[model samples]
Target: MASSGFCSLGPTVTSLFSSHALARWRSSSISPPPLRISRALSAATTVPISSSFTWDDVIETGREEYTPHNSSDLTGFLEKVNRCNRASEKLAEFIPFVIEEQIVGYIHKGFTEYLREFHDIFTFSQNGSCPDRVDGFVTLNLMLEKPEDRTRAVADVIKILGDKGIIPGIRNELYPVKPSFNAPVFFSLERAAAPYFGIKGYGVHMNGYVERDGQKFLWIGKRSLSKSTYPGMLDHLVAGGLPHGISCGENLEKECEEEAGISKAIAYRAIAVGAVSYMDIDQYCFKRDVLFCYDLELPEDFVPKNQDGEVESFKLIPVAQVANVIRKTSFFKANCSLVIIDFLFRHGYLLISPTISLSKETSYLRLYIPDFNALTLKNLLVLDLVMMII
Candidate 1:
């Protein structure tokens, strides 16, 4: 049994993105004045989060466990979901980024100023040129018709932005630009610039579990401190961004080999378990991400080794303890929490009562596990599960 009292949670979860901070984000509108006049282009300023908590605090919170409660008691999972889907009301600050009559993404109004310099490559259609076009939309120049041309032209612009430090942390990786997961690729963009363009980014996150004596345990990895994003945070056993020209299965297999030393044979047995999508708007960057989730039942004796320098360490923790870590602490990387919560829900580790209210803004997790007969299809959609957290 787990502890009934959530000692470590305190103000950490509520204060992560407090309402007061959100008010400031709302007030700091970077929408340029409605004049055709020109202003000097500069890098967009980042939104400041007013929180005193640090990553070390998050780590410390993960180490502690509450006592005297049922092992299946889960009240704090909703907080994890809230962390992933944030600043959605700030969506008004962005404008539709259309390409070939298709709305491919959204660019922040503040970031749009930077693109105004490259008139040949970017077209700002604010005059309602087409009937379907929204007011004040951005699109690529029609002259660069071919995907190759658009890619090269955008690459040149990204280079300039990278040099100016407007778009920092260039990973040198290419992410396919499209309206949806299955949509035709418009072109390839630098991975770092995806959020700035508000493109729908996709990634694969796999939960590798071991079934030992009818009990289940999960393989969790601590990200290396040297990582550019979410360093020193917990992560999925095998996870990677879906770069251009690679299938989700291929990317997951590659990540499994590189991150966890899993062979192709073992990786091949991993099942596609569905996906979770979240939309977050932060300052000049709007992140609309969809993560495809997978589950792999690993042999109990199969230990994971980090072939790449990305993961700091790996641990085989019981799934229930892992849930407590997520429910009580902000230790897991924001998106990873969603995948893990989905796993818990599907496995019957967390009981779902019908009294909870589902929020529209929450990231919707879709489960595709065929044999799991716990929740009905309609219930899965609503996710109206009760929370025992308070």
Candidate 2:
């Protein structure tokens, strides 16, 4: 069995045959972030809702199916990846896994090809105390130009995903996104090893909610476009796994202060929320997550604020508004929007699943399949790679 159920790989998904990971682990000399006092105040302060990290997701709206490709970027990426040093822990850890082992073999081959092609442009290394890092690249969040970013982004994505499937979907809810096939997706990455496999990351993204009306409005923070990841866009309430310095709960409070600039009390309005994902990469890799969510019984006089400049505008959107955004294709990225929409519907926030019925499924998986067609798949491959790499 893998180390974390969240990871998607297994035994057949062998870590690169590099024995480098066998090296001894010097206790990470890096210092963790200091505990902040603001969290205590956040637990008590409750007013208007603020952004959250737990509420982002992957958008597979218009794709038809997953297809393989032979591209220069992918081959280049693999070639560089061919060299790396991981510790015993990582060597013994999990590697990317899929039901179809053949796909894995093909993907491995494709990426190696790209690595050789881009030999001069990129560098590959798998030197870590952990094993999965042997074949994986560090997750980085980059920004893009406006809607036309697709032209510029496509090339970058190919370099990241390689032969792996780089899924794409609608960015907005209005339905007809730029491609018209998918909704102009903004978030996607190379699929990772599942969670139970011991594969993890350092980004912050937790599952949380916003309280509005009598019901608990699912609240996710929108990422500032200035963010290295989804800059100038709206995303989950708490994002980028709380930066290692704080707990998931504390991170929520920080987001309130940073994203919406909500009062301290607003951060602590704890409600009965479900699984919370601590980082955006986690959300992107492992679909399910956990976090804190509660109705902030703040006086109606609550006015939200955002210090991070992420919230150019905030509104109390009904759970359905998320779907409308996807259907209308108005949202800039698909995963976070899809997450909010799926959470709402799955957790009974929507008319169908307004209250966690357990008989629901997120539309993201089904929706993205069609949009992932051949031509679109080709484009998606390019975009998805960029989604994974620089």
Judged by whole-model lDDT over C-alpha atoms, candidate 2 comes out at 0.31
Query: lDDT tens string, model 2, 210-299?
Result: 455655433434556455444445555544332222444565567657866666665565332222121112212322222222223334
**Top candidate by TM-score:** 1
When summed lDDT is taken over every stretch of 10 residues in candidate 2, the lowest stretch is: 37-46
lDDT of 1 by residue, 176-237 (tens): 98766566899999999999998888888999999988878899898888998888778899
Question: Which residue runs does candidate 2 get wrong by more than 4 Å?
Answer: 1-199, 202-223, 276-299, 330-332, 351-390
For all candidates in order, the CA lDDT equals: 0.69, 0.31
**Which run of 10 residues does model 1 get worst, by summed lDDT?**
5-14
**Predicted structure with the largest lDDT when compared to the true one:** 1
